[model samples]
Target chain A: MRGKYLLGILVILGALGYMVFGGLGRNLVYFLTPSEYLQDQARYQNRSVRLGGLVKPGTVQYDKDRLELRFVLTDGVAEVPVLHKGTPPGMFKEGQGVVVEGRFQEGVFQGTNLLVKHSEAYQAPKEGWTPEEVRKLIEEAQ
Target chain B: MLKTQTPSRPDALTWVFLGLGLLLLPLGLYLALAAPPDVNQGYLVRIMYLHVPTAWVGYLAFFVTFLYSLLYLFRQDPRHDRVALASAEIGLVFMGLALVTGMLWARPTWGVYWTWEPRLTTTAILFAVYLGYFLLRGAIEDPELRRKAAAAVGVLGFLNVPISYMSVKWWRSLHQTQSIDLTTGRIHMDPAMLQALLFNLLVFTLLYLGFTRFRAMVAALEEAKEEA
Candidate 1:
């Protein structure tokens, strides 16, 4: 009886293992870089996709009255223009890693959601440096 | 038929662990508050103190369940099965804590409370697998058959823990990579923050030990009652 039960469980588990690791593996690419998206524009055009890249410096244009934000996202090799119609996240800043979820319309990416990807490193601000200075230092490092 | 054994009470060591953990929890919280704010996230980064240790406890508890499940299979011991169940119960709670705390942290930083990222997906799956373990345990009417099947689930389900831990690295994930990388033994955290995190981890570990022992004792009593 025990052997029979074990065999039954092993069969069930084997099927579950295939579904989880095999079927889900293909869709595991969480986000695509600008380079990756541009390489296959036809495949992603009109379809909702997340584009991960750095916000290009000097390209962040935010109109507080209109709640419209525009920026150029770059992967150092390629760049994509993004237009978002909402207040940017507090962490959103120039030269920082970000993932924008939206569909491509014309030549620009229409962003529906914006997410900041923080680095793994967690350091205390340098002694006597203000928060604004610390922010600038981090952006400069990018 | 053989007589059933009486349920045993927690011994002195169990009390020591529980007392120590309860005593040290405040110290851990103090250390976390005293830890310096991050260069970028400012005081918002203090959430790591609760999030990391709870997640660590979840991983450690599941690993314990995996080990005890293997032991139960080899020795056909009911005691081992009880321990596995106890550990898994504690693991599920801690894993839920990790998930909740992570979402709270993600909102201000990532701009959303949740996403379909790899790390989050795999962790959700891991949590489901353990829930299934308990369901499997409850469904079986035959004691031996139930033990064997639940043992199988406990052994197989733990595969998700490592997958979840490594998901950030194996795939392009929005979730940040490990601050303290286990595979490379490298830490990317400030010394003060690291100390506070480590202290919390210790406190949680002690609590886990005590909780599991106490829970297993209760399981034994319940089993004794059922048998009698």
Candidate 2:
């Protein structure tokens, strides 16, 4: 009876171990910054990657008819072009940080999905601030 | 004056804990459904009040089982075994609730009730592992062997909790990433939503504590009967 119980325990644990480690190993893609993926370009090429960065200002171009969005994602130090085949989400805009999951192609991140990488505290864009106004405020504070 | 209270009867507080929980259920539902819709998620977000707490409290209950199981192993006490079983039962109940609520939430948001998405799949696996613990416990008739086998499972099954939580980060999943940051220990929801979620969390937690206490007392009575 003791031996039988031990065997039963082993069978269940074995099956579970396979599911946890094995399933995770096969499906997981190393989440990376644009700079990290750029650093090891060859190794990460043609592989699924979750690239996170800010949406660079003025690089956002959307075609409403085609439901296509093209933008440059920048991490201050590095930038990658992203092309996504979907209507821009309501909160999606320049200067917001986002994570794009896709494969690298011909120097572009062909994004399959765009997710705000963190809590979307910026529900509505602030109304007053602009480039020049922000610059003047910062200069005065300085 | 010498007549004493009956040993079979539990104190008033136990009943009070249970009554409060039962009474609060409707209020919890009202608060959950009546809260303002989220900016992005809309009405679908109301599920968070129930789903999030169920998952969190389920993990906490399993953690209790793990603690008692470890103690049982070291101390060789039947009391610890009883506590572990009681905790697992409640944990299973909440886990089932989380799964159902999760499915209901997922269908409208993700376009499917079930997905191979890492977090959803991992949560399913967690449910299976704990259910296996109960099955193992039933299979063994010898109380000594039963406690030992069940304890072993209670310890091993806990390894799934962290994996279930981290799957959203470790792999590609449609599920939203964690809103409550554990490292910095800050919640990332709007203050109103946070309040509703926390309120329900507190009510559910007290309910869980009270329910488990009553369950453990019943187990003690059963053990006493076997000895008698």
Q: Which candidate tops TM-score?
A: 1
**lDDT (tens digit, per residue) of candidate 1 on B94-174:** 999999999999998999998878898888778878877876776687899988998898999899999999999999999
* Cα error of candidate 2 at position B23, Å: 0.9
Candidate 2 local lDDT, B3-71, one digit each (tens): 322247556787787788878877888877656565444555788888988988799889999999999
Task: Write one digit per residue (lDDT tens) for candidate 2, span A28-99.
Answer: 543577888889988877788778778999999988899889999999999999999987654466786677
TM-score of 2: 0.70
- Runs of candidate 2 exceeding 4 Å displacement: A1-15, A26-30, A62-65, A86-97, A114-116, A120-142, B1-13, B33-45, B99-128, B159-191, B213-228
List per-prediction Cα lDDT, in the order shown.
Answer: 0.89, 0.76
TM-score of chain A of each: 0.74, 0.67
Candidate 2, residue B14: Cα displacement in angstroms equals 3.9
- Residue-wise C-alpha lDDT for candidate 1, range A1-142, written one tens digit per residue: 5455456556556655764786356449878999999899889877999999999999999999999999999999999999999998878989989999998988999999999999999999877776567657756643
Candidate 1 local Cα displacement, residue B228, angstroms: 0.8
DockQ of all models, two decimals each: 0.41, 0.11
